[model samples]
Target: MTDTSSAGWGLRGTAGVSFAATLEFDAVEVKLGGRVVLDHFSLTLKPGEIVCLLGESGSGKSTALRVAAGIQPVHGGAVRINGTAVSAPGLNTPPDRRGIGLMFQDFALFPHLTVLQNVLFGLRRLGREAALGQARAALRRVGLGDREEDYPHMLSGGQQQRLALARSVAPRPGVLLLDEPFSSLDARLRETVREETLAVLRETHVTSLIVTHDPEEAMVLGDRVALLRHGRIAQIGTAAEIYRQPIDLSAARFFSPLSEIESVVTNGHAPTPLGLVATPGLADGTAVTIAIRPAGGARMAILGPGTPGRIVGKRDAIGIDICEVSVEGLDLPLGLRQPSDAGLSVGQDVFVTLNREHVLVFARD
Candidate 1:
């Protein structure tokens, strides 16, 4: 791991700027093959903050990055960097002149160029000595100082990612956009490289927008997460806010697997197989769906007492045991994450206790 504390690759020409460097998307729209991809989408990224655009496939995560990078034309609204409109009606700036850095998922390093040459590729406008200095500092910041002479093929997957990152930040662009840069790495290598990339971003203090489909990756790297669904932003907030207080059932299920139960609101509460859950601001007799996450504040115990449920399925998931319990009168089985020592079997009986704080209630359609 590289030490980011002494890394001096700061933003260029921002010495006396009063306002923070910002990236704003105002009511941006996009269409592909006569199908709407992004509709009236808007976002604002403050200086030195990392925001992750998170969603499943076809949710417009990549389109948002392209629009910000000025490679994709917007059908409506505008894209502003540092309050200057670079993308708007009848006005579009070329990608290379936008003062933005982008790293594609494939790394896109020049196969014929050495690591130092690739890093210096973005610094072409600077003098030879200055570009060399900046490239060396960028490589050192990413812990690839010793591999400057090696070609991309000679480096490991993680090192290649670092090299790509070094190249992107070498010019000290105001905003960095990464489109699923870590998606190609294996699980273990992804974790290591992701951490290194985040460290470099933090030390450099460059505003960034990273696009990813993995919920865990979004939560780990983003200061705030923008959850997209069907060409619109479903929710935007910190990871805890989005996970704990999702706007709807779909948003809640996107972050974690949920067991849903049907109920009707009565006297500000609803009765379930677990217990009565408070339903404030909802009228009586209103149909509601109760969603619970097995790993979210819920406790499971043996059939010694409480609501009895028959275990219908069981599986060992590496460090823990996941069991599905079928309760009487419930249409779907409740999933539980249990300790391995519980000695649970498929035919055994168990009891489930719901943590009201972890339960999410939404009006049933």
Candidate 2:
């Protein structure tokens, strides 16, 4: 076993490297099986930044990653790395030829090879001694130095993921692409491994792009998130900006569960059972839908002066109390999430207060 603490395998200085490396997709378009997968997709990743490509399945998230890796050909536009075009009209760079590393959803480690051998596989171009040294350092960097002789099956899922990451970064590629890398792990282990992986990527200072369908995962991992819809960017911004001010209803619902109420703008205000909500910049008599998040706005209390409501149902979730409250003047029961000790019960009278900040008024779709 090597002394992992003293190895300093984390990416240090660029040293001799002069220019910063970047990844760019300029008006990229792709088609597969005669169906358009991506259209006019454009994104840019500055050096050392982690950008998450987030969307539902078939939204072209993985297709964009493949294009960046040079595995998928673009029908139109270009893919560039460090100002050099890798994918364009008739020119295409092979996956291995482009200096980019990729880690698939499945760790893809060979069952027959030892951990050291797997890391060495990426560094085969170096001499025997140099490759051996790099492989050992990479293993130590991932806290798996003692397991160099172990095969893939002998390690836990988290260890295997770290091994895969070590192999990908062993070549010191300027850009790293991860396609749902933590999807295979269980929930608890996924979070731990994700943190570890992010720390390593930051230390390496490699511009990284991750593809995931989970909005929470994107919020946790991305410095900026690019939310795709129908092969196009629906919204792109920091997690705070995306969640606080979604461009539309589709973009808002992507980040959190919402309860919608229909209303018509009257004197620049929409009336709801809770109260009058401001709908500025809207013409009088304009129809609109107001969206509110239970966890963000709702509060429960014993029956009192607040909006009159009767608790029709109650459920105790993992860490919160979910109550279905039927308010006067509302046809549907509004879901409210409060503290577990809320003491709410079915058929009990209660007061529901809506936090004005959580209310979002949008034009009806």
Give candidate 2 regions above 4 Å deviation: 1-20, 303-305
Q: Over the stretch 1-365, how does candidate 2's per-residue lDDT look in tens digits?
A: 32222232333321112123699999999999988899999999999889999999999999999999998989999999988999988879998888888999998899999999999998888899988886777787777888999999999888898899989988878899999999999997877678768777876788899999999999999999999988889899998888878889888888877888999999889999888999989999999988887787667788666898898988988888887889888878887887786566898888878787877889985
Q: How far is 258's C-alpha from truth in model 2 (Å)?
A: 1.1
Q: Write the per-residue lDDT of candidate 1 for residues 1-365, one digit (tens) a residue.
A: 32243233223222111123699999998999999999999999999889999999999989999999988999999999989999986778998988888999999999999999998999999999999998988877676788888999999887888889989988888899999999999997887678767877876788999999999999999999999998889899999999899999999889889989889999999889888999988999999999988785456677545678888988888778887889887888888785675577888877777888988999987
Show the colliding residue pairs in model 2.
Answer: none
